[model samples]
Structure formats: C-alpha cells, structure tokens
Target: MLTKKSLIGLTALGALALNAVPAMAQVTAGSQEVHAYVGETFGDDLTDRRISGRTPELDDDVTYGLRYGYNFTDAWGLELSLGQTNSAVTGLPGRDIDLDLTTFDVDAVYHFNPSGRFVPYVVAGLGYASADLDRPIIGAVNGGSVRIGDDNGFTANAGVGAKYFVTDKVSLRLDARYRYLDKVVDRFDDSLNTFETTFGVGFHF
Candidate 1:
C-alpha cells in the first residue's frame, strides 16, 4: 500500500509535526529588561590587620546601584548589576581611612510568577569588588593614599525581589540583597559582607 519514497516522506512529516508541538508549546516571558535605581547599603563591615598588630574594623555607609537583565523564558533570566558605597575605618579615632567601594556582578534569575501583574523572583550571582582606601595609614606597606593594593577580590550575592507591573512596558521593583567578599588584607580572618535594599522602575520589551 506504500512506496519507499512515500514512507520516507511520511516519516519526515511525522518528525516535523512532533517538533512543531514543542515549538508551539513554548512560551517566553519577555525578551529583555532594563532598570535604573538608587538605594542604600547597610550592615556592611570589614576587618583588617592593623599596624598595632590587631585587626581593626571598617563600616560601610550609603550606597547606590543600577541593573540590567535578559530573559530566556518565562521563568529564566540573567542579570548584571553595578553598585558603589562609601565607608570609614573605625576604632582608629584620629587616623582617617576613608574608603569607597565599587562592585560588579552577573546573575541567574528565576521568576515564579512571570505572567502575573506582580512577579516575585530570586537571584544569585558571582561578582568582583574593589575597595579604595583614601588615606593610607601604612605608607611603607601600601604605596599611596588611595591604596588599591589588596583591596580587590571575588564576590558573591543572593537575594529576593518583586516587580509590580503598572503596564505592559513598565513596572515598579523592590529588592533586598546580601553579598560576601574576600578580605582586602590577607591577615584578616573574617570576610567582608553587605546588605542592601533598593527600589526602582523597570522597562520590558
């Protein structure tokens, strides 16, 4: 009832039909998203080996950040962010160790309610950060007042956030995140850590 050519053609047609089923079932959340935001970093601290042979503490103050992301599907996406903060070395009263920090990160994100007006997401990422010490307390150990030596390291963070869509193209976003980084000075045993909160507007296309 069938020729060889007909059998081959039918088999090819069946394969194409099967492939089309999956293609038709696939759904995408959005192609891309960009956001600009300003926020504050809190609960940030550092420990460093001091000239007195004891570890001294530093505290981070206000912070600001911006982020951009791409979505592969309704539930999966990737993001990149940049942030900056100011800090001061504590426990050393007279000596000023003004520090400014900058960080860059890339993350994988998941949206639990991608199709809803309000979407909740979780994000985790790997990053790099640098601390600029404005005034060097140890001149011989560090070269200049803006000591960048031993102030750069690997970083990591994780957080939760939500987006409330006001329209098809715009949304309001709020997030809180925490990060951990390697110590600036080798002798310090504790790693640096920070917690931050942010609110911003996002656009999707």
Candidate 2:
C-alpha cells in the first residue's frame, strides 16, 4: 500500500540511481592531452586588384604546431594551439612576395566514441592570423610601391579528425580543417579561405 508521500520518495530514489551510472569512455574526465604536429597549408589567392590588376596566388607550404587540451567530460574538451608557416605569393612580374604566417586558436572538441580505441571527433573554433608580406609591389593602378600594415585579424575554422590509440596514453592523430580569414589585410579582399591537414603524435595523461 503506497501512500502519496511514499510514491514521491520512490521517484526521487530512482532518479538518484540513474545519476550514479558512469559514462563509458576510455579517457576519463579531467584528463589532459598534448600533441606535436606537422602539416601543410594549401594554396589560396588574394584579390590584390592593386598589385597587377590580377589576383596573386599563394603556394602550398609547411606548417608545424603544438596543441594542449583538457577533457571536461568523456566526450567534450577544450583545446588551444600555436603554429607557424612559410609560403610565397607568385605570378607577380620580376619578383615574388615571401609570406611569413603565425596562428593561434582556441577550440571546442566533441568525441563521438570515447570508449573505443579509435575515436573520431569534430572541432570548431576561432583563431588569429598574422601575415607578413615582403616585396616591392608594382601596383598597376597606384603605380608605386604599396605600403601597408602587416595582415592580422580573426579567423573561424571547423574540421573533423580521428585518433588511433596504440596504448592508453599514446595515440596517432590526423586532422583536416577549412579556415576563413576575415579580411586580415584591409587592403585585400574582404575574406580569404584556406585548407590545412596535419598528422602527428599525441599523449593523454
């Protein structure tokens, strides 16, 4: 014979029991990860209508970075990364512009299968890019060497990746992402786009 008060108490106990069930994940909450990676940034173009009345195309180049992340839950985490790249802008007459690039990013990551030895994930974030372009430009319209500040601004990116664990603490990682540069160089196009892919070793602790 259950009274009204007894029914309410039973329901509360059931809720408590459900809350005690643990999430199924190989990496427990509060774990931290570090990765060292090397990769490439593919080519892109700048609408430098002032350079030669033609757009300048940038060439593919090497990139390297380090990443640090913290897992808030079995399936969710926060990440920060730092990297650098060296590339060149070609198709200009008589000379090419050398570009030096630096990047920093903050991201949120979601793991789909934290309990598996192979985990696939997605990441999306905001970033900053600083670009240095070195050349004496022959601005067709301006007819002079263009003087402008270094290109530096905000960027947004999203990507998918996978990790294969060889041991509980070590894994191999592969990731690819598309990034949008929001007019870092005010003198150029309103936005620039690029793609990058990386592979590396990671450790969880």
Candidate 3:
C-alpha cells in the first residue's frame, strides 16, 4: 500500500538508524582542554592584478597561535585557533605596506589511533580573517589612508601531528600544517590567494 517515495524514505531511515546505534553507545563525558603554541609560518600571496607595475611578493613570515578544544570522545573533538601573520610589500619607493593578518578558526579532528599514546590526526576548519595594511608613504602621497577590513573565508588544512602523552592530563605536541585560505583581497581589479605553513607545540588537559 506504500508509494515508491514512502518506501525510499523508510529505507533511508532504517540505514541511518543502523549507523547511529554504535555512535550512541560510544558517548562519553567531554574533556575540556587548552593549548598554546608558537611557530614559524611561510606565506605565499597570489594576486591576479599587478600593483605599482609589479606583482605582490609572497611573504615568508612567522606565525603563532593559541587553541582550545573539547573532546567529546576518543576519536572526535572540536578546536579553535587564533593566529597572525606578519609581512610586507617590496619595490615601492618609501612605500612600505605592513600586512597583519588575523584568523579565527574552528575545526573537527579525527584521530587515527584512538587508544595509542602517540595519536595522529587530520583536521579541517572554517575561518574568518582580518588584514590590516599600514602604508606610511602612500598615505603621505595621497593624503589618505588604505586598510583591508575583516573578511569571511573558508580554510582547508591537512597535517600530521603527534601527541606524546606525558601524563593522563597532559601531552606534548608537534604539528606541521598547510592551510589554503580563500581569496579575500580583490582590490585594484585583482584577487589574491593566501597560504600558510605553521609548526607549534600544544598541551592537552
């Protein structure tokens, strides 16, 4: 007596129920933890438009950040990070542009070995960024100021990091991550892409 649509819906519901049974059985109390890290970051700036008759140089710089995480289970967790990049522009006469980039990111991490002391994981996140540009000579020449505002973007990151457990409540961490940030700057009839590599330490509690 059931229509085809009804039959398909019932079958899908059955599959979902079967898949969720194990997840419900594996739930545990969440662990709240905080981490701080400092690392060197190399950045590449890809711009479609030329500035002052030259392409914007990719900046290799240092970056540092802090993060906090909540582990809902042995295999799954959520994390947030705040990081910054320092860079400059070249080839402009007394025209130096200092770029300060800030990012707020939230990601989900999945550990490969849930029960091992050395846990390696992969992560992906969404990020929001702000770029502050300081141009001393450009402002002096034009009697005006130029600044890049906060922009919304998506970031995809994949890295291998090992967690060495020092104690039940603490761990030592080392990570190498490569982040691809969406194009945020599209001024002067051009678009720019930003990328960063970071290494740092973290403590888990």
Candidate 4:
C-alpha cells in the first residue's frame, strides 16, 4: 500500500500529467533552465527539548527563490537553488522571535518524460541552511545569538515536481519537497523536518 507521503506525491504528479500539451521545443540535451518561484514552507520543530527558557521552534512562512539547471542528457540534469524565508521562532511567550533563513541546494534530477510538455521529475540533493537570529535569548546567562543548526549538521532533501511548457520558451513549474535538517539547536536532536511546495515560471534556453 502507498504511504501517505507517497500518495501526496502521486496526486501532485497526476495534476501535472493532466496539464500536458505539445510543446514548441522539447527539453533537449545542453538545455539550460532558469526559474523564479514562490512557495510556502510548513514549519517544523527545531528541537525535542521543551526546557523552560530554551526557545526551540520555527513557524510556517512564505519562501521565494531562483533555480538554475543544466541538462546533460534528455533524462538527467543538475540544479542549483537558492531560497529565503521570513519566519518566527515560536515557543517564546509574550512575543515570537523573528528570524530570516537562507537555504541553498544542489540537486540531481531525473525526468520521466523530457519530450512531453508536462514533465515530471524526482530530485535528491544535499545542501546548507542558516538563520539570522534577530537577537539573543531574552534571559540567558552569558547569552549570545542562538545558532540555528549544528555546524556539521548538513541538510538533505528529496522531492518530486513537474513542468509544463506554456509556450515555446516559457513554462510553468510545480514542486514539492521534504527537507531533513541536521540538529536544529545545540544539544538538541537534529531530526527536524520541513515541507515545501512551490509554483514558478521557467525559461528554457
């Protein structure tokens, strides 16, 4: 039986398939893609610890970014993505701690139908994530800016998405991914996870 996550992926891919239309030019080898996208990120707990005075949560927020990809073959490609989010650090009373996050990833992609107008693909990658804390914890001894994740804790992700050529050189894209974070905070478990979905326009060259 398909798990819940699998079902969700299938549903998203199905929608892309339904939008398939003949394209003026296919995603041929040596093709490059530049896309500008906006999406939502569902927040995840930064840590399992609920200690008093230790703030350990991130809130859901909107994200925007750009992606660049180069196809080496009709079926294989690599992409570099950069995104940013303005979200709050929850679990703090009286008010939330606002923070800004910057994320980068390099993913390898496999297209199911590079020749089709609606092309669905699977992606996996490793990357880095960092956050800028607005300020230090309100009441901590020897306080300093809190680090968002372990210095060595690397970020990894896997997801599925699709693209539909709207015109000869312009295309519409949809993507959804789950990111597994390294330790979110010092001394806390790094098993944090976040969900993201985006829609964008792509320019093929």
- Highest lDDT scorer: 4
Rank ordering of all candidates by TM-score, starting from the highest: 2, 4, 1, 3
The total of clashing pairs for model 3 equals 0
lDDT of 3 by residue, 1-205 (tens): 2223433543454344334322211212376656655555565543444444455543676666677888888888888988866666544434546776677888887766756656777777777766655643231113444333223455566566765444444544567776766644534322344444443334344
TM-score of each: 0.73, 0.80, 0.69, 0.79
What lDDT is obtained when candidate 1 is compared to the true structure?
Answer: 0.66
* lDDT preference between candidates 1 and 3, better one: 1
Worst 10 residues of 1 by lDDT: 18-27
Model number with the top TM-score:
2
Write the residue-wise lDDT of candidate 2 on 78-197 in tens digits: 999997777777666557788777889999999888879789999999989888888533455456565433578888889999976666776667899998877545465546788989
For model 4 the TM-score comes to 0.79
Taken over the whole model, the C-alpha lDDT of each candidate is 0.66, 0.74, 0.56, 0.75
In angstroms, give how far residue 29 of model 2 lies from its true place. 1.0
Give one clash count per candidate, in the order shown. Answer: 0, 0, 0, 1
Per-residue lDDT of candidate 4, residues 73-117 (tens digit): 999999999988777778764477776777899999999888887
- The segments of candidate 1 whose C-alpha lies over 4 angstroms from its true place after superposition are 1-30, 43-45, 48-55, 138-150, 185-189
List where candidate 2 sits over 4 angstroms from the true fold: 1-25, 48-50, 142-145, 184-186
